[model samples]
Target: MVNANKVETEDEYIHVRFRDPDQFDEIRTPEWAEDPAHSVSEGSEVRMGQEEGSDDWQVESVLIKKNVGEDKAKDQAEEIVEKIES
Candidate 1:
């Protein structure tokens, strides 16, 4: 039930519109709209990591569902880090 569309990109930031009715109702600016590196939820984290031997970095973000346990966000971070490292 989660989806996203890239709206725009700049040298310093990228704008993405996320679709999650369970979390939002309409196409609206996120609470952390000002910072592409900010997450809507405290548990989640958004960041850009430089790729190996490349100047460009990859945009990554993850959110833990409410049904999940409290440490779900940290678990998500670990998974993302593992994927990026591999």
Candidate 2:
């Protein structure tokens, strides 16, 4: 996921494109999966849900599997910023 701090409110919903482990390129979004209902902190895992006729995937919940110390969080943030800048 992109760094939460760098994301603006208006650009919260992003279309993601990535390569899978098997070397296949894929895009994982439905047209309606744009209007997310919740925001998550950096390093949190999120669950997305879609209503039958809805156009966006809602944020169902967030899971913080582990707590990162301030130093590590800062490092991660910096790495994210570098990625975005490049």
Cα RMSD, each candidate: 15.4, 13.2
Write the residue-wise lDDT of candidate 1 on 1-86 in tens digits.
22333233333333332322333222222344223223333333344434445554343334434444435444444454344434
- Candidate 2: minimum summed lDDT over ten consecutive residues — where? 8-17
TM-score of 1: 0.29
Best by TM-score: 1
Local error of candidate 1 at residue 55 (angstroms) = 2.6
Any runs in candidate 2 off by more than 4 Å, and if so which? 1-42, 68-86
Tell me how far the alpha carbon of residue 6 in candidate 2 is from the true structure, in angstroms, after superposition.
28
Please write out the lDDT profile of model 2 over residues 1-86, one tens digit for every residue.
Answer: 43333221112322111212223222233333222211223433333455555554433322332354344433443343333334
Q: Which candidate is the best by lDDT?
A: 1
